[model samples]
Target: MNTLSSIDYIIFVLYFVLVASYGYYVFKKKKAQEHDSKAFFLAEGSLTWWAIGASLIASNISAEQFIGMSGEGFFVGTAVAAYEWIAAIALIIIAVWFMPVYLKNRIFTMPQFLKTRYNDSVALIMAIFWLFLYILVNLTSILYLGATAITGLVGDATAGTPEFQNILHLIMIGLAVFALIITLGGMKVIGYTDVIQVAVLIIGGLATTYLALTIVGDKLGVGNSAIAGFKALMNDSPEHFKMILPRPAATTGTINTPLNLDIQKWVVLPGIAMYFAGQWIVNLNYWGCNQYITQRALGADLKTARTGLIFAGMLKLMMPVIVMLPGIAAFVLHKHNALPGFSGSKDGAYSAILSFLPSGLKGLSIAALTAAIVASLAGKLNSISTIFTLDIFSKYIAKEKADEKKLVITGRYTVLVASILAILFTWNDLLGIGSEGGFTFIQKYTGFISPGVFAMFLLGMFWKRTTGTAAIVGVVLGFVLAIFFNNYAVGIFGKETWLYTAYTYETLGKDGLAHATTEIPFLINMGWSFVITVATMIGISLAGPKINPKAFMTDKALLKLDNRTIAMIVITLILLSALYVKFW
Candidate 1:
């Protein structure tokens, strides 16, 4: 505790007070209009492009990304930034092809689209799965990680108490604050606060980056020293920094040597292959279909919506610079011995960030980190409440044609309840119970629901033959496959195979098998989830009865077009090419 200067404490307290005050202001300004399902979940379709764009960025980029993904970039290199670049393409596609349908239908929730396109049963199932996953996986795990990081950064102030007890207390406090904000106002509050959050996140990220560069530059004593140092770090440890590291075979007890021919191959191409082939299918279902996220765009007019989507896409282009570059810089500046507990071989970019913080800057940096975490918490809290209130409670328990005011009140209550559950779940420390590094639990749990939910909505949208029965089967199968692949197949089966053993031995030596493992098993599980879901849906649709195509598509909906779609596609392709050149 003595190591933490008073400056750090003051900065933290100031940040907390400012955020709390802002939340209160947002709550106070919320319109008192009838808060029906539409207003509660979708902000009564009143957002403009700027608010929509900022909210999207704030919601998407959070502590999980800054700490976890940046840690990945530090360990693996810029190749990890592929997720952002790839998403640029996905977002464009959604803007051009997907948004029109959603907007035209005036759908509030993605599940509602399912109900209309498939059947009520499909919608209900999806709603249940999404709600459960939100509480158990997304909301809880993120809160845990954010809370843990804050505790670590703040040190001892919240320590000495029982570990789990302190974490639970912190999470509950955070969640309660978040719930209060959302309850007072719905998407309007979220959007307004997001603009502020996004601004803070960018400024803070850039400040960190600039400080790191200056420190590195001064150490090496050259203008190009920072770049040289970065290159040296990568060059000196080829295996660690290389975009494509070796992997064990699935069956042969051999190395998959040929797969590493091209650097792009190692980066995210295989994952991208799964993505376009499968992952995008799910992401579209997320951005285009998911209510909580999409509600921002849905609030905009058509042109504003299109602009918002494009603006978000453009902002994503800067993500690697903010998240990945800092990690790389941290690794370069600090070297292997930079931070305690991360000295053996793997780069400790995240640890380095903490280690390298100077006195005054430390407080500001911690404040920024706190802001990122709180922003994520706020978005998830609002969205989870939105989905629960709109899709589940309104449909099943409360059938009244509630006015907007009543709906807003219900939304507030829902956020409170969800926040409580999330706080309780966070207290359990399920996030840290696993063997994988920090935040692995989040990725694993998300895999279970994300793939399946994605599958259900995608098929519901495109395939007229997809019946309620087929949807249920696809959703269930997707979930089962995602779990099996994520847990049993990758964790157990993948490790024991002769191929894995051989590859591990060859690439990493006799002990290679011990070190050579993926954190996410992304390639295997993601691929399996998609293939199984698509096959089951198609096979079942063919074997069983066919559904009316008219229900899924209409003349006006099918033929609609806007120039924004073309622009998005072009921009995405150009950006993808640029990423390949820079990282590969």
Candidate 2:
């Protein structure tokens, strides 16, 4: 590992101090108030659209999306931008249809909605599932990745050792500290800090993107070299860069072409399909329905809440340019080589960032990376604490009529506990066990829970006949399907044989093809999971008796036509399609 220059160390120190000071300032402000748990957890129902909007973006675009999604874009192409585009549409839907329901009912959490729409048992089940999912899937894994990335950038001088063990410890500690600060003031604090953090994150992300383009352009010997390199890389590795790469045939060592020429065929396609189908559902449930996230919105008046969602959606559209483009640039700049002083040859986007960065800019870039990761961790920690306090503690564990001050205290303690647990879990080194693969284990696990959650929420919202029993059943079935599709049927059987064959045929003709096949497990998992989940939900709904539709219909929650929501959704979709056609 390289030594950190004095400047880098100074920058790091300054960042830490600034973040901590912000936390302290928020704490002081909240402490002066006649505190109640509701105020702490819900920001005293006071937040503007801008604060909520920034916080929402900051919370959602964590290390996972920055590192993992960007890496995928580097290895593949712009096709991975689906996450952002899909989310844009999803947010609009939430603003139009879902926001009214949440605001009208004055619900505090996503599960709280389930409780009202379904029953307490159903709500409890969803709450428990979400809590576990947030801890295991979102918080822990993000901390692990963020820490790993930051430690890598800081090198051995600050981290003490270049070994994975040392790195993981540093990450967990950093995440825990940030979590503590976020918990100090609850949603209001999170909102205020998020405004600052989001600024840091964007400036940092854009800085890296600019530095990357500059360095890569210099190396390739052309002003437009970054763009040229991208085109060249695409030409050389057409298969890797293509959005519609072919899938492996069912029989070993065969290649199967889809009947539809226009359909995308990359390994990411299935996941992308699932994302398009499921992500909007989850996003609406999140931005519009989920309380910890939406508490910021609910705190706002209806106008501000609407404005925030719209503003956040606009921000979401810009993410691909910042996060995805750099990854693509990385692959173009550092093909088939280790970054300077690294032990092994680097692969994909992360390697690109390391190799292409210059000396002074490297420090600033690293700080930006750290900021993005911290922003993500802080947002999740705050949200998780909010859910625990409102959905579980206030309802089940402690029914005491606590004032805002006492409630804030309780919330701070919960944040501390949640942060500790997240750090501990992240420190366990699950990613190390699966480090051999190009993709991280965290991404694989995310594929399982996210898709399932998305499916359940979509069915529940749109289908009035959908029962609590059906929703619960859908969750179970969706989860099982995710596992099977990700692990067994698609993962083990899909890509290995054909990939080996293609490589072998290129090297030594048909004779070597038999042994060269490699599996594309993610594609298979995603494809089957989608098929099965949709099938199961539809079949069950049909087989089961229909509940009265009137029970699910709440006129107050539905937007009036004057709102322009329907027109916005249509126009957004059309514009996105045009962009996809023009760019990808």
The clash tally of candidate 1 reads: 11
lDDT of 1 by residue, 26-139 (tens): 656654544555655677667778789888888878656777666666656665665677667767777766777777777767677888777778888887877887777777
Please give the lDDT score for candidate 2. Answer: 0.62
Residue range with the least summed lDDT across 10 consecutive positions in model 1: 498-507
> What does candidate 2's lDDT look like per residue over 1-584, in tens digits?
55457776676667667766886787687775536666676775567778888988877777776777677666556666766776787677677666776677666677777777667776777678777767776777677667666666654543334475676586669666866666566677778777777887788677777766665555565554446545554554454444334543334333222322112223345433445444444455456545446667766656667767777777887887677767766666555442444332222365347435656556666666666677666766766777776677778887685555555666677778878787776676554522432234554565565555555666666676666666677667767877764445434554344322111111123365422323344534544565567667767777656763423566753466444444545666777777677554
Candidate 2, run of 10 with poorest lDDT: 499-508
lDDT of 1: 0.63
Q: Which candidate number maximizes lDDT?
A: 1
Off by over 4 Å in 2: 32-34, 157-164, 224-265, 271-292, 336-338, 341-348, 351-360, 399-406, 431-443, 488-552, 556-558, 561-575
How many residue pairs clash (N, CA or C atoms closer than 3 angstroms) in each of the candidate models, in the order given?
A: 11, 15
lDDT of each structure? Answer: 0.63, 0.62
TM-score for candidate 2, residues paired by index: 0.82
